[model samples]
Target: MVRKIFRVLLTILGVVTGFFVADSIINSNYIMNLGYFNNMVAKVSLYVFATLSFGIILFLLSPIFYKGVSKLTDAVEKSIGRLSASEIIFGAIGGIIALLIAALFILPINKLLPPKLEILGTVLSIIINTVAVVVGVDISVKRKDDIMALFEGWKKGSSKDKKGKVKGVAKVLDTSVIIDGRIFDICQTGFIEGPLVIPSFVLDELRHISDSSDGLKRNRGRRGLDILNKIQKELTIEVQIWEGDFPQIAEVDSKLLKLAQKLNGKVITNDYNLNKVAEFQGVSVLNINELSNAIKPVVLPGEDMNLTVVKDGKESGQGVAYLDDGTMIVVEGGRKFIGENINVTVTSVLQTAAGRMIFAKQKEV
Candidate 1:
């Protein structure tokens, strides 16, 4: 019904446009005599013919155009449906700011240029303005901290709590870090300082995942969301969900890197791949796994430690146990005593790109 209405409206519009074109052709001589038009009516009449022909072609193709547009709209809506209204509003504000900045630089050139070049300048200004606005919005959304920082200086003198001590480093908690669930305990300790940031997109992704049909993924997603709520509600530290996104960059990791780079902040994540990618891109990453490994009590080779043989390892007669933090300890010749706890001497420690591994053998202690 709406399409039919649009078609009728477009047809009426076309007919009205055609009448104007026909009148212009009939009154070309009179129009040519008008000042500031430079007797360009004959050329302008040709342009009118071109425009009318183009409009007619567009009218004929309207149905096809509508179908294509509808499909694109559906795709966009599905992919970004999780976005909240506030995020959309924030993006719009950023875009407008960008457009205004672009126009500020563009309008001067448009006004200063010669009359003949003015038309070209106007077209260029529009293009530049659009690019600036979109780019500005993208940066503002991605570097949400930078956008906030613009106004943050106004509150500098308001904080009179600590004057001379060094400030703590801010840790931007990515979604994976929160989902991993170790960060909560890490923050409970006094080691990591400053505020924690949770980007709005990360929250949206978590929410979408939590609503997924797969049981395991759904659980993990919900766990992450729950962890986020706990940090926000229970923890004493400042937890903020930053409204930031880079629409041009589809991948969340890319947005994270861009945000980290912009804010001079370190990304805290447990994702192994993201850690490597961020480092390659020159973005600083503080891997939660790495921190756990580092802070775990140092157990050197030949050191005798008490461990439990809970399960069999891949190698024959090897028993596997875990530390409180879930670090794996492999004990050779202890597989038979699966239910018993025994002392084992560390044979070697294997460190990988992801984390640390320890190998040990039954020790007489």
Candidate 2:
């Protein structure tokens, strides 16, 4: 029924177009001089024939038009679906502003053109409007972060009267830190402040890892996702999943640095390589490994400590033990007591970017 109605409407539009065409041709200076279209009957006959012919043609082509319209609607819907609400709002505002600016120039410009160049004026006006709208949307998209930040700052100002006000910094999370799972514990301790910003690309990488063929990678990936869920549910701080991404950047770490710079946020990760890269790029990084090292119990030389000799170290008589926090202790001349718990005196402590290592000699039996 809808198709039939649409076909009828199309036929009517075609008939109206045909009538206008016939009238224009018949009234033309050349046609008037020929004197054949002067008679009322002849003109009426011609108009009726043109209208009927166009109506029939359009009715026949209605199915093709329906298919074209359907495809167009689907394409538009898909494009709109990919745009975020903010993008759409900005785009609409941009388009309106462009049109208004175009209108301001179009009237005077059109009047200044020669009558023969009237079509040129119309074309130029259309081009100007198109260019303006494209430029506006591009600018809006590129400056979206700045615009959002301005709005957010204003909002925060309005709510300054509220008690227990905490200023939140944007803390962007990296894939490695999520997989390390220490972030969850750190958040639970209430030491870290700010809105935990998880990039969409990081989440995508995690998903890929979780679906990997290698069992170890798959487990790590899944654990990261689980940790993210725990943080979102248990932590009092805001956990935001940021949808913004930089397509120009190929590597996740590079993209993360770009995102941090854009948000004016710090990158949180346990990745040594990423930490160094961020430092070189002048981006702030909150390294989980560094944090862990800082909080580990301080060991001084001549301090007595007890540890189980779990394995032999690289040295011929060095037995390896670990502190509760996983700090390695190298016990001298204790290789014979690999399976036994022994008291050791801390001889020295070495700290590196990786972690802290304690060098000690076994206490006398």
Candidate 3:
């Protein structure tokens, strides 16, 4: 139904264009003095012929035009999908201002050109309008933060709090942190303040994962989605799904880093590689693994603790055990005691960027 209506509109536009063309030709005097017939009959015949021919051509080409229109719409939708609401609003405002400013000179410029060059003047006006709109939108999008800050400052009279500290910063969640699912607990504890921003690209990645063919990946993806729903519904803090994205950056981690820089926010993740990359880029990161290690019960050297040896370690005669918090402990000479609970003395503790590891020797009676 819509396609039929669109085709009819296109045919009407074609007929209107043909009428204008016929009028221009008739007024030019070249085709009117053909001496073929009376002026009135010639003019009427030309108008009818042009209108029918153009309308039929457009009606036949409607499908092709429709395809082009569909492609253009998809392209526009995809481009706009990457932008946040604020960006679109500011971009529209900027474009309107640009067009208004261009209107001031459009008439004067058209009048200055020779009558023969009227088409050139019209084309120039179109070019100027197009350039102005493009420049306006680009400028607005690039300086959105400054624009927003101006409005915010105007509204509040000041953005700083009574303590002189800047207001809250968004906590950007990455893919790994979402899947790890400890963030829910952290948010529940109220340690993480401010709005938690889940980037749209991150959500896309999660959806892809959830739909993965592999069972493990699919489960992880679903779990992440569940965790996100839980955070948004169960937690008091705001969980926003940010639509801002960087098309140039292919990697999710790179995109997250760029977003952090843009928003002046921190990236929260449990991925060690991402943590290092973010640190190198001078973007603050909150690593769940690091946080877990920090809050684990501190064990000092010579401290005695009971651990159940569940498996053998890589080294000969070594047994591996785990603390309640998942910290690994390597027990020396305890390989024979697999599946047995034994007392061990903490020999030393090793802390790395990854996590903490403890070496222990079996305590002797």
Candidate 4:
């Protein structure tokens, strides 16, 4: 239906253009022969011919141009659909400002020039406008880090990026990593640097879990939100709430994988499943669990250590204890030693994709 309407419009436009073209060609000599109006009328005729000729050509090629523009628009929308609302808003503002500034410079030049030089002025103005729009978009994309840094400075007491180095990287946090909340500590330590991106969809999922009837899940979600708040308030990192998501992906793990790939950044996660999924997708991943496990004290088997058994383990007669870093230890035959600090000998180590576990027995002090 729309195509039919467009075809009808094209035919009307073509007929109007032909009339103008034929009229100008017929009246060309007559207009030139008239005294005092010769130069002015000649210019008018020239412009009219050019305009009509161009319009006619465009009408003839309308189908091709329409298809091309439709495709281009679709591609642009798809590409930009992943960006956050704030990002797109600011980018558009930047583009408009650039165009306005270009017009400020170019419009004056156009008005100051003589009538004969109008075409040249118009061409120059167009060049300026084109350059401005291109430069504006280019700056928006290329200087995303700088813009983020500026926002960071605004959030902080400072008004400048630290030494003008912009970190545009996005950090994708995982559930376990968020629950552990060492990322907040890591940010406070200033060891981890970059823009912190918490996908809004992830937050939504978190909220859902937090509101769940399950007490444990509710507690975990609340803890994660608290940690998120702490990071947002105290740290210099910009915590972005990314609403862009893949509806086709059922799980957050898969969504995280798709998002990391889209953003071209490392996934800051502790989930073994997510890490492996990200790796399979060729996306970089920063496993917080791996980092924690790596930084823990490397105690070999047969090494003796002092620990206080706090509670009973799942196995009968086994006492469980934790280190300062939260590494769990199962002390064999140490149930009697519960609530008392005692030395223990490391028995065996079990390593998994999640982390590490140690099985040990109580030793004489």
Candidate 5:
């Protein structure tokens, strides 16, 4: 229905153009001597013929015009959509200022041109104004980062990113790693560097969990809070409380990854799944589990040590013990020795995705 109405309007515009063209030709000095146009009826017929000719031509081309307009409109909408509000506002202001300057610049040039060349001058002026506005808008929007950086230096919170984000190389801590309480030990040993970041969102999540109805969650949350306090007060390393957060993002894990990315830092977490997700997303992550496993003492077969069997393993006639660092040691044929200290020989060592496990046998008396 809209297309039909547009087609009619287009045809009408073509008819108006044709009428003015006919009238211009008829009144011209060169055509005044033409006897054919001198006749009133012939001139009327010529006018009608030209109007209908152009109207019919434009009517046939209406669909093409409609499609072209549609494409142009879509392209314009997409271009505008990609611009933020500030960019759009500044671009509009720049374009307007450019057009004003262009108009001022062309007025004198137009006056210098002869009357016969006035149309050429007008075309040149249009081109100049258009190019000026385009250049102005392009410069205003594309250089926004550089302009924003000039102001960012004055503001505080970490440092200035090259592209206007928080520039940091500090370690960003997650709830799991914090609550595990091993990060403090690692920091104390000088293995982890200074300026550790604790994102506000992670703190809020810790607070929520600490106040949760579930006992385990409550304990874990409170422990994380306590560990954070300990790291801040007891550790010599610099610990920063990052007050920034992604309010639009709901999940705390997702927010942690985003904060890490924005800070240009590594995420320190113990969650296996979160580590996988962070790796998949191309964000750098330092898994405390992986680090712990990497630093665990290398145990070789045929090594004998005195250890206590704490519990029975899954397999028959097996007992499980742990080293000082929590790496599990599985003892074969030592299930009866549970709750007692025993001599064990390291038979084999297994490196699994979960962690390291050592298989040992009861040593000879």
Candidate 6:
């Protein structure tokens, strides 16, 4: 019923538009000079022909146009529905400011213009307001912090009392660190005091991975889910499933960082690349790999440690041994002692975000 009404309105508008268009063409000096437009009968006939032609064309095409408009309307409505109250408030404030600024700019021009030039001022006012909207967006982006602060001041009397800390509120967990399973242990120890946020997008990725035909990915995904269950049921820290997602962001890691920024929280991850990206973006992150490295026992130079070389290192005649914590020890000239328990004196230690590497040689007999 609404669609039929819309089609009827469009056809009527088209008829009105066609009448004015034909009248203009006939009244114009250049067009009137044309042979066909010279006669009154031909001019009257053209008006009727154009009006009926335009109305028919519009009536035929209304369904397609209506579908497009309906789709666009739905998209906008959905987007607006997802916006928070603060965002809607900010948008309203910005629009009003833009209108006031445009009015101020045009008021002088409108006053200086002659009565006949009033339309000129009206056109300029429209153009200026269009520019003002763009200018408003740019200014808001540049002074976004100031605008947020102003709104916050209005909502809350004074911020002096509130430290404005979101640290304890949100703790975003990424896929890599969740699958690592150490985060559950850390949480069980009662170190993490706040709610752990697991985004819906990350959960979707895990579900996909868990359903993968690839055995390794499937296992890893299942393990991640199992760890999350443990963290929820076994640990005391609150686990929150964040339903919000950023469709504009493609990568899971990128979305994780964006979520952390929005929540004003820290990301917990073991992915080396993600760690670096989060640092570059100025988002706080707690790296599981780094934590593990920090807690590993420090092996001073000349300190004797017993190790059984399990494999050969990158260098020839260098035996590789791993600490229980997964720190690698490169034992020089100990290739012959492979699979044999031997004492080694640490020569040096190379510490990195990836892990720690200890360079040592077998101890003297």
- What is every candidate's alpha-carbon RMSD to the true fold? 7.8, 3.9, 4.3, 9.7, 10.5, 7.8
lDDT of 2 by residue, 1-365 (tens): 87888899999988998898889889999999999898999999889988998888998998999889989999999977766677788778877877888888988999899999989998999899999888888777678778877998899888773556486778999999999999988888889886899988999999999999999999999999999999988888778887766766889999999999988899999889999999999999999989888989989999998889999999898899998889999999989989998899999999998798999998766
Each candidate: how many clashes?
1, 0, 0, 0, 0, 0
Predicted model with the maximum TM-score: 2
TM-score of each: 0.62, 0.81, 0.77, 0.52, 0.53, 0.59
Candidate 6 lDDT tens digits, 1-365: 98999999999988988898888888888885776687778988989998998889898999998999999999989977765454556666776788898898789989999999888888998899988876775565445545664776676664453544333657999988888899988987867766699988889899998999999999999999999889888875667787656767889999999889887889999888998999999999898877887888878998999999999888889999998988889999989999999999999998775678899998889
Native-referenced Cα lDDT, model 4: 0.79
In terms of lDDT, the poorest run of 10 residues in model 2 is: 159-168
Q: Report the lDDT tens digits of candidate 5 across residue range 32-89.
A: 8765598899899989988998899999999999999989999999978656677887
In model 4, the worst 10-residue window by lDDT is 31-40
Q: What lDDT score goes with residue 300 in model 3? A: 97
| Model 6, C-alpha of 7: deviation from truth (Å) | 11
TM-score of 1: 0.62
Query: At residue 101, what lDDT does model 6 achieve?
Result: 82
Q: How far in Å is the alpha carbon of 364 misplaced in model 3? A: 4.9
Position 96, candidate 1: lDDT: 86
Q: How many residue pairs of model 6 clash at the backbone?
A: 0
Which portions of model 4 miss their true places by more than 4 Å? Answer: 1-168, 210-219, 247-250, 309-320, 332-341, 361-365
lDDT of each: 0.78, 0.89, 0.89, 0.79, 0.86, 0.84
How well is each residue in 86-118 modelled by candidate 3, as lDDT tens digits?
899989999999899898889899988999999
- State which candidate, 4 or 6, has the greater TM-score: 6
| Ordered list by TM-score, greatest first | 2, 3, 1, 6, 5, 4
| lDDT score of residue 169 within candidate 5 | 66
